[model samples]
Target chain A: MSPVNSPLAKKLNSFAPLSPDELTCLADLQARRRTVAAMTEIVHEGQTDHRAWILQEGWANCYKLVPNGGRQIIGFPLPGDFMGLRSILLRTSDHSFASLTDAVVTEVPKHRIDEIFQAFPRLATSILWAMSRDEAMVVEHLVSLGRRTAIEGLAHLFLELGQRLSLVDLVSGSGFACPLNQYVLADALGLSAVHVNRVLRQLRERGLVSVKAHQVIIHDLDGLRELAGYDSTYLNGDRPAR
Target chain B: MSPVNSPLAKKLNSFAPLSPDELTCLADLQARRRTVAAMTEIVHEGQTDHRAWILQEGWANCYKLVPNGGRQIIGFPLPGDFMGLRSILLRTSDHSFASLTDAVVTEVPKHRIDEIFQAFPRLATSILWAMSRDEAMVVEHLVSLGRRTAIEGLAHLFLELGQRLSLVDLVSGSGFACPLNQYVLADALGLSAVHVNRVLRQLRERGLVSVKAHQVIIHDLDGLRELAGYDSTYLNGDRPAR
Candidate 1:
């Protein structure tokens, strides 16, 4: 995709307009893209580096290893998501980012970001907005793990992913590409793999959703939303796109 | 407390040095203070308001009511912690802020904040740092809920609260004021009140911690940290205070 046609530009443009120069700068940043194989650890926990990355294509998630030999997937970053902006403030990564599939990402050095902030203050505000949105999603995921039931948690996760993908025009009608397996779903939703399988089967039997060829088809989006008590207000979707 | 001597100033100073004018602007913002009784709801979920708040004194927390008729405590804001900065970008609150104790807070109108950003660009960066830090803490809490055992969760909570309180001089030799009760602890840790009581008793029996008359005393801080697998990296304690 061209830089102007990139998912990152589309996602950011959903919040506000970017001038031609701004778009060119963002496009130039993406010109330095690099690809990694599936399950590659892009950055490890406790790693200190002044560089971040933008997910130009494919999916990645952040996770932390538990003391009891388990791992908790903390977040899933979509194509347009910026992976390491949170660490820019602290200069150290607290969790590890691993690609779930063959992926492409653009490394954003600290100096380049500083230049952006210096040249375009408005873009800096938009960057803050993006980081805040990322935090909001994390907060929502916490509620899911702490309060929601197993079924509700699964449903909420699907709904959230669908909504996010929809923002970048990745969703087609009620279906979208979802390459995640039951194990990934289990880790992200705080369930055992067997439990995730059971939940998926139950949802399919109830005509709520179906998975085929690594795609998730939501037959009852409203029903799933109601069951999960999902609300998109936290997503800040109403921000005017200039 | 005077503006410069306020916890908000101290917290902001932890990130970067503020010029006298910047300090005055922050202090002047806090001049319009309001006090609410204990357990008062400051803002409800989905409420749209252009004003944010700074917690000047006492304790407040953000929570969301679950579909199962339970409340999940999303965060506990310490003195000097700014609330609703996330909402400023979204224009709506995703969680409700309630006072855990009689609390003093300063309202910051959005217009005034815009003025601050225009006049003090560096302060704007500091605000971004604060929000990112908040998100990091939430991510940590998510890991605790998803992976940590009940005992470990309780220990982790105590350690985190102690470390945070100590940042504002609220700790004295491993003890700090803890006005929270078992119910509040249950909500925050995803446990029942009875379970919280049991965990507290276990910690005390193990000579790890003790709670008396709204105060928590750490008998073995290092031991508790080890048991909880606690690391303060996410708290950004290494930031230079100016």
Candidate 2:
């Protein structure tokens, strides 16, 4: 897709349905950008600053590193999705995010954010919706870590990532890039690397899916969904125009 | 304190300084209410119907249980905090909440929420602030679990809980009732009960704090805060004030 029609562009357009003139105004906001290599640390845990990043391409995992060698992957950001929304409300971010691939991102300054929220009230509300959705994801993760079995947690995370990426057209059908590696996956799943490898092998043996290279090929989306007890209701977004 | 002068009542009054008439109107909304026992499962996980719960007294925790014998405590809901904000946006919650103590709570039906939102825009905004704070806490926990050590995670959680409870006068000094057992603490911290016990002992041994019979006495609040790397900036309601 052209830059104008990119998923991030579409998301920004959806929030305000920007006028041609407003889109032109947003060009400066768009121009404040950079490309990051895979494994780039976009945000660091315990840092205090206000830079909201919009992922234009590739994927990333926002996480926190716990002591005792445990890690918690909170959420994955896909194309067109915004990270660092917390900075807007809290003035600081307590989590760190790293790119899963060579990715392009646009970073908007905090002052510009205030201008955008003030200029586009509806968009401001939409951003609030975005934050709310992010919170919902956190809640879901809490459930997965707190309640689901290891297999269930893995299946749920896979299903969720697939569904979210698919929603943004980053994935087609049931397959997409796996984003983070097994090491990062271990942190997200609250398990050790060895344990994560064993779970992945069990998943492959069960004919659920395969993670090779960077691609996750879902053999049976429905079956995996069932195994994960996945439900789509938690991921409500603006309905596509009929 | 009388019902009108209660801390929770005063907290709500601080938002808009409700007039006598408005207080009466709001009081009528909770004319019929019930007190729940500690450990009562008030709201089950995966329920679609959402209710706005206003705590008249006591505490509760929103958490989820995994199939693989794990638990994730998402957030501890204090008096004046709202728990089902996700239901407003996501339509369903995958986490269930149980009271941590004998509590009086008023149930505001989801439908009634809009009326309240419209009736008091500031309160509506306050509700949103409460929701945002919960999201902020989730981000902090993601950091605690993902990056911090086991000891830091437990200590951070303790400091956070104490700070929140202190905000509402739940703690007189550095000591406060924890109201959660080792199993629940393990679930919240993503550690084993044995590990959690060890961490708590470490805290005690270091002259940090002490926990006994569901009560946590923070011997050195500032010391615990430093160990946890906690800054109360996120907890501050620094959202759009209108």
Candidate 3:
């Protein structure tokens, strides 16, 4: 792959510039590119010799199966996002990842991380920036599950997803092509499927948001943001004071 | 701070070896060291000149105030842990930090991170590993909130806290000096104080665990681990395949 054409280059450059040499090094990390179908298990829990990827299209989720029989959705990986990159340091995979939609990914060899850090410190910083952003998102999600009410949690999630997907150009600022069903929402928000249905109904009745035909439409974006106390700072990347 | 005497040097070297040069560089990052009283706000929400710290003694928690008036506890920062370290890449702070117990910390200037990564790639990688482990813990907490039942969540949290504190030698394998009150446990586990009271009663009745006079005693570690589906791999650092 040419450095100029690498999707990762486009992604990281959105936040921090990657020098031509760093871009070439990043492009060299990609071992292959492939598309995975929806509902496919891309990485399973406890798998050794873990692999890493950069998402180029569609959405995916990382999850851990509950001993009681269900799974908890960790976070959604979107276009220009990374999947399994952070887990490269672990001896074994701590969680499984699956596709929420048909997904395209660039397989990056986990072994090249050290080389990248040594040869291209700026690129490594950008990678760390990406991981830090991802970590912030997860922390915010934990807050939602622990503190937000059902209505508030659903609203917060939609606003977050909208802002994130908008950054990747996968959706407009107001709406997105969403593949989540009530079950997915329930798992992510720590609500029951029935409770999720009720919250969606409440949101629709209040004219705050709507989900229909695999798309999420926010009729009152400002209202939902206010209700959820949503802030985009955690998801955004800014110039670091080096 | 002398390199040989830096507590962080001892902590990081437990997982990965730091050369004398890297250790000296690491020691240079600390600007000062101080002790803080309990219930003190170490870092406030929305403060722009965000500072970073390495926890040297006692415990602190990062949390966000919910719009509804309560706060959601994000994670507890223990000895050898980094708080606000990841937020250095962020333009603004998203949450607040408070001391759960009287705490000691090493204030590390954020600007020196670029120099560390450029001069010591191995040390940068170790920092990334520590961050990854911290992120994994947050992910696990999210899983507990989303998927685990009342008993399961509390069990999971206690087991996790015990194992983590044991790593820093603050606690034995079976128990720890826990300053978390019922209110703190309730906030962390997404349960009401009343519900947390009931769960504690149940655990005590079942001879699983006990919390008394600010210390937690685990009578049956295996039972709690099984109930919580606890695994220590996420917290353990292993030799990375380069």
Candidate 4:
């Protein structure tokens, strides 16, 4: 596929337009597109090679497994997000990452990244900007885990996802396709599956949001934002790109 | 003080020694060191200026305040840690940062950072490395909050802190000077102050570790590590710099 049509290029063009030459450079890295099966481990904790990839399609969860079969889903790397960038840069996988659904990823080998950084240094800066944005999201989730109530936390997550997907033009008005199930939501929100079910019911009854089948329908985005005290400034800067 | 004499340089020198020219360049920024009183807000949420600082003398907590006066401390910035790099890079403060004790910090102005990035581009790579390390720690904590029990979480945090502090030689064999009170502990660990008190007592009884007054004494380091399942490789790379 051409770089200009790639989800990553499209996402960047939506915010900060990349030059034609930059798109061509990005296309070089996407030469090896591989499809991963749903629920397959793409990278595991303690792995040495520290593989890196750019998500071209579908959802993947970045997580860590604790003792006795416990898992913590840190973040959902949506399409257009870089998977294992930090671990790749640091040269070790600190956590495991897996495809939550059948996904397509363009593998970015370590040497290729180094080549990009040296040949096109500005690309490195842009990648770091994306990483900083990722950290902001993680910090926000940490806040939810530390303080926000279950309802508020779930509300915040939904609103944030809507805004993010909207950036890549994946979310339409009032709803978006969501692949996460109650168990996955429970893992990410630090609640049990039963609690996630109860919270979904509460949101549905209040006409805020509903996770019906495989979609998130945001009935009242304004009300949900108010409940979650959701602010988009953290995700995007004070003045986002036009 | 010269950059070599600064805590930031000392910390880096302990692991990866900086070149003489690099030290001189670093000192240019540290010339504007400022002292802040304990419990003072260095940066507040939603600040437009997006100021940045490096902790040279004391600790600070980077946190986000929710509606109705709830605060969630995402991470504690120790000596040598950049206080607001993520926000400063992204050009907005998503969280508020405050000194936990009377602290000294060296401010890095936005323009100055740009100038350094232009003059010594390699320095930019090192800063990115540090940020990646910081994210690793955050990911680990997210795991604790999501899956680990309170005792296990607290133990993991303490052990992680010890390893981090030891990198700068702030921690001795048996104990370390701890500035966090029960309230702060509760805030960071997602527990109530009463729960923190109980956990401290439990650790004391179990002969693993204890926090008393302003110090944390590790009675049995191996036992505490065993309980926490703590590993240091996440914070440091596979083969860390000596």
* Model 4 lDDT on a 0 to 1 scale: 0.81
- For model 1 the interface RMSD, in Å, equals 2.4
lDDT of 4 at A61: 92
The per-model lDDT (C-alpha) reads: 0.84, 0.72, 0.79, 0.81
Tens-digit per-residue lDDT, B50-104, candidate 3: 4577888788888887767887888898877888776675445567888988888
Q: Which is the leading candidate under TM-score? A: 4
For model 2, what is the error of residue B65's alpha carbon versus the real structure, in angstroms, after optimal superposition?
Answer: 3.7
DockQ of 2: 0.29
> What are the runs in model 1 whose C-alpha is more than 4 Å off?
A17-25, A89-91, A118-126, A239-242, B12-26, B89-91, B111-126, B238-242
Candidate 2 chain A, which ten residues in sequence have the lowest lDDT sum? A233-242
Docking class of 2: acceptable
Pairs clashing within candidate 4 = none
| Candidate 2 local lDDT, B129-191, one digit each (tens) | 556567778877766665577888888888788767766678876688767888888888777
Question: What is the iRMS for every candidate structure?
Answer: 2.4, 4.5, 2.6, 2.0
Give the CA lDDT, 0 to 100, for residue B63 in model 2: 79
Output the better candidate (3/4) by lDDT.
Answer: 4
Best candidate per lDDT, number? 1
- Model 4 agreement with the true structure over A1-242: per-residue lDDT tens digits: 56567777666655456777878888887878889999998877777675688988899998877776777788898888898887677646677889999999988878988887788766666676677678789888988888888999999999988887877778877899999999999989889999999999999999999888799999997899899988787666445523
lDDT string, candidate 1, A26-118, tens digits = 888788879999999988877778888999889899999877788899989999889877666545677899999999998988888889889
Best-to-worst order by lDDT is 1, 4, 3, 2
| Best-to-worst TM-score order | 4, 1, 3, 2
Question: Given the true complex, what DockQ would model 3 score?
Answer: 0.50
Pick by lDDT: 2 or 3, better one: 3
- Single out the weakest 10-residue window by summed lDDT for candidate 4 chain B: B233-242
